[model samples]
Target: MHELIVSPYMGRFVMVKPGRKEGGTMPAYLYRELAETAPTSPCPDWLVKAARQAWHTELEGRPLAPAVLVRDDPGLGYGRASWELNLGCNYDCEHCYLGIKDFAGLELPERVRVLHTLRDAGVLWLQLTGGEPMVDRLFTETYAAAYDLGMMLTVLSNGSRLFLPKVLDLLTERRPDRVTLSVYGATEESYDGLTRRKGAYRLFKKGLDAGHEAGLPLSLSMIVTRHNAHEVPMMRHIAERIGAPMEEYTNMVPTIYGGDETLPTQSAEHLRRRKPFTGCNAGHTFFHVNPFGRASICKVGRDPAVDLLAEGVEGLSRLGAIADSLLLRQGGCTGCGLQGTCGTCMPLVQLYRKAEAPLATYCQHREKEESV
Candidate 1:
């Protein structure tokens, strides 16, 4: 396959590599011309110049062509997706939203079919996530398959497995757009205590060092919970030391199955006011898929999902309507004056309601909305 990908992003035409580490934009005329050119045709002078400028590489005669370009499909509207490879994880954190972490998923053959379906659905930006996606046996093979299919991939992990030789080698050779690792604590005492896995902190540090040394693109998600609230500053220092951008997450939500078990772990003092919900293009421009190939509008609003395996890409036709129905301010939120300033979305409100969590956790009607 060619090293570059030329496709339309949202409403604009652009050129990007499969890993998404480098790219630039091209005019609509060039984009249209490339689509009509033969795959084996000579790399035009303009494209060669643009490629050299973007990738900083010199092309040798006919090495690049129209085959590298991704054409738009009038039938498919979605552009991105996230797939939960498996719900299995080595570290069992008390605050994990996926309550029951089971080590179960589709085998390689079926998994390949799912990847193909995603590509056929016009999904270009894809995220591979799970309880811990790295723990899945077919993780590398699945990743390679998706990368080969021209999808810009991202992996969400806890960083405990980045020290593995096979995983490191695969990632170094075929880089992902980004590898987002979650940081639980700055010290072993708090990290291990929170994850309930001894040596978890050591493994996490080792993974971080290995990935950095290998020159992999890395980012951190600082998960602030009651167990590690005191170490927030230390966590920021660690991220700064590593030179990776870090984002802090203080709000704890109910499990995907609507269980209240995770709510007790929230750090009340760290809870921040959420921005008001405006809108999103969940089911229309992007969607989510479970390990079993069930497609949903998004992760939180998962009911009324489409079975990709049974109904194929055509099943996505129902998701737009599903999203519209779910986003309606019905249920307990109906006709509420606070609707204009509500920070939480409808589906998440439903989860909190199902868990019977305190109204202070999500609703704007709570007496003390400042803290959880």
Candidate 2:
């Protein structure tokens, strides 16, 4: 495995280290020149200069072998992707968007195939997520495969299994770009109550401390639900104590399957107003995949997904059009006068409508246009 990756990301050239802790942009011409350099040739002076400036590494006279320099293919224009390894989780939180958590996923053979497919699809940045990714039986294998294939990996977990020797060792050996753990609460009582799992908080704290001690790049998602809304201050304190950046999430939406069971968990006081819906490069520059290899424009707009395993990379040809159609303001949003100021995107609005959720939760129409 190379210590550095020189690759094309959505039309831009980037020089990134393995774990992605440090990186910066490089000239396109230089990237091409390096790509054409002989493997056994001396490491180019430009690389040394860039590495020194960007990563502060001293590669004075190293050989230009695959271990020192890995070049990534700019495949199919897709640069990033997220995959749900499985829907299984140890802690079932009240605010979880996955309605039904099942302990099932593709076997090892199929999982490896999916990872290769992701690599071939030009995914340099890949997020391995799940109901709780660590709970999947083949989680470590899948992670290792992706990392070895030169993708900068990110793991989204609940911090419940990071303390285990196997999990910690694997992470320490092959560090991910980031380990994003969702913090449910600052106290055991509040955390356990919110997750509906007794003693869940203890395990989470242990795992968090271990991960930090192992020098892993970690971040915290401060999940604010009605059950733990009072602990926001303490959550911030915990994040600061661990020296990891924290982001608060207050807008609780319906489950991915359009179930309204999670709506009650929203923290009314902490619900922040979303920014105006500009636009996203979801299907054009990136995509998402489920545990079963179904690829979609993004996690929110999962319909019209392509069976990646069956159709292969060519199937992704349909996602850009799918995204375009989904983004069109239709159904409940059609001809809405508030389209200019609405913050929610059409796909998410479709989900809210499917759940028959209160308009106040997702729309400005009820509050502004109708009332006026």
Candidate 3:
């Protein structure tokens, strides 16, 4: 509220809001510290750096309390949609929620339609995701179209696909705002064991190397699980190796393509309990759209409650019903220490708490997933 919370990369320049400066810009020295301190969302240290700089400048400056502040207002946040571009991936991982299902049946024209539909919804920031975005049929085309339309695009990738001349060309054309790569095992055996595919570790590294040589802005992520939670430092080392920043996420329950409210099969059952992220309108503020026109407010929730995929763009604009469904932070959230500390998913904690760990699913068991 007083001192601007900024990324280490930025100094006090523009202050987006009057409140605490968590995700906004700061001096270059504070990026890592700010990334570790920010309450939610970890993309890249530079992402935080850029956001911090923008917040005080182009972004909405500080929230004003009306004499009688109404809840209907935009408040201190923003709305965004996460569209799973294609389910198919170049590699298969053991904890992959979509797994082989990402490659399921889907018409090519239909997939393209989804992009246009999302564009129509006035989505400012669009996320292209899936088993692996590089494997998508129209990935290059889609990127080109989105970039031309002035939509800020972010891609979730494994870093293995960027080496392809065509894919590399797409990156050159779009110059995407962000590319998040998930790394699980630091060693080939660990990464291959989790991915269930050998040589993927090498491929991911090759992609990271290529991206760096090409001067692509990048971010890295890691999911702390039973086998690799202790490997946080190693994961950080990997990020540093690629000249990117890193983030560590507490485990969460998987929504499995937002399939059903079921316990997460791979999450750690018993974790260090600190607090819970509840009462937040995850659906309204955060959105998850699956292939085949399926949609959910919270990316971690299995049941979308509403099917926007079938309903089309108009359905997505009516976000009121979805926002209202979010459970509010009652006692459990306010009383705990980890309340706003860790990156918490409200839909995930409320729905499933398995036998092994409190948080079931984690950044898909990858090192670079902490950004999620």
Candidate 4:
């Protein structure tokens, strides 16, 4: 009988037909490995590739493109979580939302406590993001802790630290479900130039090479700002060389504290705003926990957070209520002439405007949409 395997890491379903060469039987462990790595047994190279392509196509058609699951759980009753392991990072990018400063996050014991809390809350998948999670003092132990909990892990990093022997060993032993490396530049000139750190590009390249060799599932992303926009093509070429797909993002909102808007991009029209603003999974089946243990609907989303350390799963229960409250406060965008055209949502309105009023700067979309 043929078996259909769901790869949570790769987000694809592969059709496996046991080959007749080995007594017409393939072991179950082989299926698991195949699901994770796309091994050359029980399937040809072409079929494996085709299956992956089909899966990505399916994902793009869905409302939440990155969430790959066999079934859709609306409540996300037991779902995915994003952890900002720490606010400390190794590199300082000019357009960074956090403004490129280092600070201590939770202590190691507290971090472990947070992991236990998430696993208990039925959070099976975790995305460990950061100011650069690698720089966190407790990163390795916390990663091991998550792996021990049988939770699928995805790490977002600048890739500079993966070259260390200890880091590589941890990744090789307890392989994360996926690793996404943020590519700063195709060359050292633009990379170190943008980050203002000498030899940053070299370290990033070394990390990528090490990660590729360790067989880690990798992807590349470039935050397209004015300075590095010209190097985007070169970055894509680097992604191809690393055998990882490239994702480019241009819609950079101001920092959570409304710090700066100096980064240039395509246009306000390209922002990720949909009518009625209902596509987000934040505070429902998904939530973001920042360095200080503040849990919100999303990473960029601030205000109305429940302290995960103090509240635990019980606090998480209030997120739905918090979300309901945010949704209720839709403000002027509720029935504006540019409702469908503007990207303003409650969290964004909170970010840029005064407590009682919407910001006219954010309303620039109305004029643009009307003039068109």
Q: Considering summed lDDT, which 10 consecutive residues are worst modelled in model 1?
A: 66-75
The segments of candidate 1 whose C-alpha lies over 4 angstroms from its true place after superposition are 65-75, 368-372
lDDT of 4 by residue, 208-301 (tens): 9999988888888887666677787788899888778888876666666765543343334434433445446678877889888888877766
Tens digits of per-residue lDDT, candidate 1, 1-372, equal 557777666666777775557787778888888877777777788887877887765554764553365555434777889999999999999999999999998989988988888888878789999989999999999998998777788999999999999999988877788999999999999999999999999999999999999888899999999999999999999889989999999999999999999999999999988888877898988999998889999999999999888888888988999999999898878998888778999999999999999887897787444555
Local error of candidate 1 at residue 218 (angstroms): 0.4
lDDT of 2 by residue, 1-372 (tens): 567777778778888886657788878888888888888777889888888888777666877776455556645898999999999898878788889998887888888888788777788899999989998989999998888887899999998999999999998888899999999999999999999999999999999999999999999999999999999999999999988999889999888989999999998999888877877888988999998999999999999899988988888889999999988899868898878878988889988988999998888866785677
Clashing pairs in 2: none
Tens-digit per-residue lDDT, 44-158, candidate 3: 4443345456553322233221110111111223335677767788676545656344565346566656666655554446787886877777678767775554345688898
RMSD of each: 2.2, 1.5, 13.0, 9.7
| Top-TM-score candidate index | 2
Candidate 4 regions with alpha-carbon error over 4 angstroms: 1-76, 261-276, 354-372
Better of 1 and 4 by lDDT: 1
Q: Candidate 3 vs candidate 4: which has greater TM-score?
A: 4
Where does the lowest 10-residue lDDT sum fall in candidate 2? 66-75
Please state the error at residue 64 of candidate 3 in Å: 34
TM per candidate: 0.95, 0.96, 0.64, 0.74
